[model samples]
Target: MRAIGTIWMVARREVKARFLTKANLVSLGLLLLAVVAGVVVMDYFQNRDTDEPTFTIALAEQTAELRPGLEAAAAGQDTTLDISTMGAAEAEEAVTEDLDAYISGDPAQPEVLVADEVDGQLLGLVTGVAQAHAMGSEVAALGGDPGAVSEAVAQAAPDVRSLAEEDPSGGMFGPAYFVAILSTSVLLFALISTGALIAMGVVEEKTSRVVEILLATIRPASLLAGKILGIGIVGLIQVVLLGGAAIGTMAATDLLADFEIDLTTAMLMIVLWFFLGFAIFALLFGGFAALVSRQEDIGSVTTPLTFLLFVPYYVAMFMVPNNPDTTLTAVLSQIPIFSPFMMPMRSAFDAVSTGELVLSVVLALATIPLLVWVASTVYQRGVLHTGGRMKLSEAFARR
Candidate 1:
């Protein structure tokens, strides 16, 4: 009960303090503006250019007879092929100018001439049309029915198959990757920024000798817990607000309607990881801050931990493309220290297994109490020591 009261007090103080600050307001405003701008940019690009393929073909002598077949083939492939008769010189010039858009040759056995190498889709389309025309000509030469040969060729084309049992939630990797990267970036930046603020708050109070006065009334653990809890709640709030903005924007724009976000699962994971991550890092930062009486010493003590944070970030990056199934990824995903970032990222791609995710969450929860105990011990030992700076080894030993 005492612990609960202390946590509530700290949370209230931190929330009020932060909300009243001009810097915090400015940061929030900028964050909102950036989110809006990002949504607009994404929408603009998504709706911008059309995807329909347009082909301009320059046919050589005798190819005009194949125009009907070529047009039919182009229509089948959802492409617009503009067939024009040209002399060799004119065809060569057009091919040299835009190889991708121009295919040169007789309507029958038309050879594609391009300024450069053609794309596979265009090449395939052109090849299929040429094959159909060739088959028709061969039948005519053999004194067989060309119409029957054409019908047989059309019936022989293979059916396109969809690989997945269910349609993919998102259209493709583009939007999935976008959401994953954007959400991770926002969450990571928010956590690190707010965690640093919590550290600063602790240091400020201690440096001003305000902690000494407060300690006379509150238990050290309560004070520490309160500060961490309060700031953590605020951090969670920001995360929720930002996530809501992103999801709402996506929903409104129909950006990821095909791809289900599993909002409940995502929110649960975000909330869980935010608290666990905040507790672990914020507590460590608070303890580290206490080791230094002056602000200058704060950075030196925290530098090592700061560098450690980047390891999980980079590990998550490498794992994104690896589909979260690699040996290294599996191990890292289960590790509490890396789970928050790693699991969420892998989850975004539907790469994580249910067992792996549950196991990771369990491990992270199990480790939190141990980390909190260690951090609190360090805080208790170093908070009152107005020394130059405390070594990590010494801080632990004294605690």
Candidate 2:
């Protein structure tokens, strides 16, 4: 019971230091503002009225036969082009004033005039019009059906079949791939950043010799537990706020109406993963921190753990977003440290099963006890040393 009291005292200090700071509140506000701006931009694009370029172009007599062909090409791209006909003088005036481009002269080599560099969409339209007109002219002269030739060319490739029940083209929202990736990445960043803060705080106390006075009454294991619990709670609070802001923004904007992404399930995963991920690192950081007597030495001792954090993060960012289907993805999502970042992301693509996810959570929970034990041992032996950094081998060799 006294041990618990000592731990709570240390934990209270850490929680107060982290969450009660004015800096944390200001950063939270700024992050929320950024999130709102990002959500607005994403919403605008996602809910845009058309997938096509809003274009106005002038057409001439020579290029009139190519209008249908140009529209056909735009249709294939899932974009529509607005086309209008005009005389040579009017085409030049229209393009110069407000239109996208002006088309005149021969259909075989239509002349296009623009105020600046032609847009890629407009370029595709003009080029398709010219090519189709030229081909049709040739087919007509050769006593063949121009319409049939155009149809055959348009469908040169056949559509393939998929055996999977889920949409290969990623259903309406593709399980909200961008949102899933962004959310998981944010969680990872927050976990690492918060854990780093705890480590730096430990180093600060050790360097100032404040830990010695505290250590006289408290068990090292209790101190380690208290620090981990306190900072983790603060981290969880930030996670809740950040995740709530994002989820709220999406819900308010109705940006996810067409998607199958379950926000409740996702948020739960984020909470669980963030806790597990933070616990292992935060405790490890506390342990490694005792190996150093100075703030500068903090980074060197914790470098390997920092790399460990990145492996899951990079994989989650680069690989998982592309669809978490590879054997590597499958294997990593079930592993302890990597699972925290990997599973939440894999869930976004519907790549992981419930059983697999539960197993991952179990593994992470199971790994925590071993880490706590190791970190406590390191803290017990190395916290009293003040000369310089202690070697890991030496720390282990201690009674």
Candidate 3:
């Protein structure tokens, strides 16, 4: 009870001191605003090329059969396209009037008439429709079922299926991938920012000898835990706010209408992995920063840990996108350092089994006690012995 109370007391103090400051609150607000701006920017790029579509494509008599193919081609593209079949003269008349283009052919050549030289999307649609019809005709002449071939292609092109062994997030491709990317990015940002706060706070106290006085009243482990706990809570709040703002912006602008992005699932992943990633890096950060009293030396303390962190981070951000089922991903998923970063993505894609998740958490937890012991020892020895940067070997040796 006494130790818990002391830890809570320190945690409460840290939280208040950090967040109650005018500067910190302002900065936090700015970060949330930046998230909104980023979401808006993403939205703009996503829907930019699509204009207010009201297009009429006149089809000559022979080309009338290409309507089904044209409709299929335009299925998921969400365009308002009108296809009207008429005589060649009427089609040409329609083009000179209000129609955007005309697709015509049969014993002549597949052609699209437009005011401009070429419009890629429109031309492609006309070509695809005419080609599909030609293919169907050729198959019929060859005594094959054109209907069967079309039934297969029509079943494919625009729809989705989930035959992959491990599904992430139990959602579709677009949503699952979006959530995975966001989760990795947010988890990385939150852990680094909060861990640095812990490191900087430790250096500040040590430089002023404030820690020396606090040590008489509390154990080093308790103090470190409290600071970590405090700053971690604040960091989590920031993540939630930033995420909520981004989501809100997307919803308001309807930028995500086409995507199935499961924000809820991703947020849950963030909460679960954030603590694990933060703990591993934060303990090491606090322990290492104690070796240097000067604030300028902070970078040296954090750089090594950052490099170690960045390895798994890069894997999650870059490599995972390319191939999640590779042996390397499987191997890294078992490691505690990498699991916190990697497992969430697997879960997001529903590629992870329950057993895998449980095992990864257990492995991550198993390492915590050992690292906590090592980190606390380093903190105890090096916090009081700072002149220049204390070598990590010296800290281990002295401890």
Candidate 4:
């Protein structure tokens, strides 16, 4: 009870010292604005009218039988066709911007009248449709049903299989991939920034000999816990606000109408991984910072740990999106340290099994206690050592 009370007091002090400051407030506001601006930009690009060519084709009564085939072929090639029924003479007269081409005369050998040079796609569709129409006529003349023969030809397409598996996130260009990229980016930024803050705070306290004063009253482990908790709370607030703003912007704009993504589950996973990842990195930063009394030397001890954080970050960014189901990604995601960065992305793509998720969670949770022991031991031994920088080996060794 006493330790808990002391820790709470320390945490409250940290929150007041850090979160309630004017600088922090202004920075938070700027970050929110940036998120909202980025979302709006993405929405603009995503929902804007496309510049793909649309062919305005007019069909006369004589060539009306080519409508279905022409329309289907145009659609298959991703071309838009504005088809309308009209007389051949009227279509030829109205061939300014309103009409591109008009098909007249016989259905089998259609007279395709164009305003100028013919569009390759438009011409190909017309030629193919006429040929198919002629073939169907031949089939009808041979006492075979034209519709049944067409259906048989359509069903005769051979099945194709690829050796490379299709990407679940739709080839790294989909909305789900964007969400995963954003989530991992947030995780990396939050973890690295918070971890750096924790280290700097520890070094700042040591430089002013404030840790000694705080240590006289509270246990070192409790003090460390409180500081991490306080800074973590501030970080979580930033993440939640930014994430919510982006999500709200996307929803309002209907930017992801074509793709299905569960914002709730994605947000939940980010928070979960962040908490676990923070625990691991925060403890290390706090422990390492204790080894140095001067702020100048703080980076020497924490630099290696920063690199460690980036290893998982780069892997999550480059590898996971491309090959979420690969053996390397699967194995790394299940590991305790890497899970914080890897699992959320894997889960987002619906690539992770329940067993894998359970195992990853268990491993990460199990590792925290071990880290707590190691970090507290290092901090306990190193916090009081002043002047010269203490070696990590000396911190772990009992006096």
Candidate 5:
């Protein structure tokens, strides 16, 4: 109970001290504003465009029979192809004279005009239609069944599903990718930003000689724990704010309506990883900050650790597309050092099994105590050593 009180007091103090500062609030406000603006701009662009493509085609006089097949193909794609029945010479003239104008010209004007370039899928449609028309003409010449040829063509028509699903209102590549990217970006920023904040807080207390006074009243371990708990709450608040903003933006734009996201599961994973990731990085950062006597030395001390954090991020990117199911991913997922980033990503894709997820959580939970012990020991030894930057070897060598 006494230890809990000390931790609570430290946490409250850290939250007030950091948040009440002008610099911190200003930075947070700016970041939020930028995020909101970006969301708005992206939404606007995405919503503004129509899905249909415009195509224009000049059909030869003899190719009048091809019109129905072409129309059927274009209809499937929600596109209109302007068909003009004209002589071969007239069709060639229209295309050669002005390609764009000919294609864009009124469909009723002439059948020999050029058409606009449509989507690649529409190219297949055009080919199917032309083939069907050719088959019909050949059947007519051979005195065969035109109905049979038409039936075969209909059977062979491509089964094209919408890139944008109608019922859920989610796009094939858009919402899922957006969620994955947003989650990754948010988690990366949260871990790095909050970890650095913890470092800065530690450095500030040591530099101000405030920690010495606090240490006299409470155990160093207690102080460290309290500081971390307090700062971690602050980090959680920041994440909630950012995450809420993102979710609200998506909801406002009706982007979430069509997409099926396991929000409950995702939120749970996010909160879990946030704390675990924070605990792992914050303690290390705090210890590193203590080793430096001056602010200038802080950057140098944390640089190597920062690089370590980046390694998992890079690996996550590479692994997201490839072997999301391989041994490497399973190994990385279970490793606490990489779980904060890698596990969340694997969860996003629904690639991890229940056993793997449980094992990952257990491993991460086990690592926390070991990390905290090491960080606290380093902090206790290096905090008072103000002569020069303490070497990691020297800190470990001390009792």
Candidate 6:
């Protein structure tokens, strides 16, 4: 009961130290604003109507007969055009500013004028219209009806069919991909950033001998546990707020309608992964930071762990999306070290089975006790030794 009380006290201190700070408050505010702003911007663009006419062109009187053909070609290709009739000089002037192109010269063989490079779709529309007009003229000369010939040519096209299986997760740019990226990115940021804070806090306390005063009454393991729990609570708050803001903005803007994510399941997975990942990282970081006395040496001791964190993160970001159901991803997602990063992303893609999730969680949970023992041992020995950097073997050695 006393140990538990001591840990709770330590945890409360950490939370007060971090949560009550002006900088943390400002940072939280800015992060929430940025997240909501980003989602709003994406929603605005995603819902914007793009069906309106985007290309404008002016036709001279001579090429005015080509207007109907051009309009027909544009409409057939599902392109919207804002076309106008004007004199050749006026068309040429408008092409430099208000118009995308100016059409003049012969009806069948017209010249297209533009101030800059021609748009591919616009150019294609012009070519198709000119070819059909020239063909119509030839058909008239040949005594066949031009309109009927054009209609016959338009109707002649091969029906195309694809044999590839449709991906339910919507390929690379679908809702699954969006969730995978979002969840993984948030995990990466939370774990790495918060993990560093745990390490730096350890180093700071050790440097200032604050841990000595605190340790007089509390166990080393208890202090470590308390610190991790407190900072973790704060970190979890940041994650939930930022993630919830993004999701809420999406839902409010109707962007969530386009995404097929099971919001409840995804949020649960993310929160679970965050706790698991943070526990593993915080312990390792705290233990390693005890090896060094100064804040400057914290990075050197924790660099390897930081690198370890990125391996699964990069794999999750790059490999998992492309090969969600692959053997490699499956194997990594089951491992304790990699699962924290890999499983959340895989779950987001709906590639993980319930059995797989349960097994992964069990494996990760099983590793925590072993890690706690190791980290507690290292921290217990090294937290008091404050000279040069202590070796891992030295910390593990019994007095």
Best candidate per TM-score, number? Answer: 6
Clashing pairs in 6: none
Stretches of candidate 5 above 4 Å error? 37-50, 54-73, 80-152, 156-178, 254-260
Give candidate 6 misplaced runs (Cα > 4 Å): 32-53, 137-148, 168-170, 173-178, 248-265
TM-score, model 3 to reference: 0.74
lDDT per residue as tens, model 5, 1-399: 999999899989989986768997898888888777778887777666644666655555555656777777778778877766555546556765544222222222322233554347555665566556566667989999988878886688688888953633143344654565566667778878777877877788888888889889988888888888888888888777777777777677765565677655665677788888888888898877788887877898678778878888778766764566789888987777788888777776667899988888888889988998899999999887776888988999988
Native-to-model Cα distance after best TM-score fit, residue 36 in candidate 4, in Å: 4.4
Q: Give the TM-score of each candidate.
A: 0.75, 0.74, 0.74, 0.76, 0.75, 0.86
Stretch of 10 with least lDDT, candidate 3: 166-175
Please give the distance, in angstroms, between residue 304's alpha carbon in candidate 4 and its true position after superposition: 1.3
Stronger candidate by lDDT (4 vs 5): 4
Selected candidate, larger lDDT, 3 vs 4: 4
Q: How many residue pairs clash in each candidate?
A: 6, 0, 11, 0, 8, 0
- Pairs that collide, model 4: none
What local lDDT does model 5 show for residue 249? 73
Highest lDDT, which number? 6
Residue pairs clashing, model 1:
11-230, 63-107, 99-115, 169-258, 169-259, 170-259
lDDT per residue, candidate 4, 1-399, as tens digits? 998888788788878887889998999899889988999998887656543569888899878878999888787778889998898557868776578888889999998887788888788889888988999999999998998888888688889999997654455768778888888888888888788888989889989988889898889999999998888887788778877887888888877766668878889888988888998888998888899989899889778988999898888878887898899999999777789889988877888898998888888889999999988898889888899899888987766
| Residue pairs in candidate 2 whose N, alpha carbon or C atoms collide under 3 angstroms | none
The global C-alpha lDDT for each of the candidates, from Candidate 1 onward, is: 0.74, 0.81, 0.80, 0.85, 0.73, 0.86
Clashes of 3: 11
- Model 4 off-target regions past 4 Å? 36-53, 57-80, 83-120, 130-177, 246-261, 318-331
- Residues 235-317, candidate 1: write the lDDT tens digits: 88788878777777777887666566775566666777777777667777777777778876667756767766667877786
Model 5 scores what on Cα lDDT? 0.73
Q: Model 3 over residues 48-138: C-alpha lDDT tens digits? A: 7556455688787776767777776777466667888767767666777787887777712477887656567777666676767878888
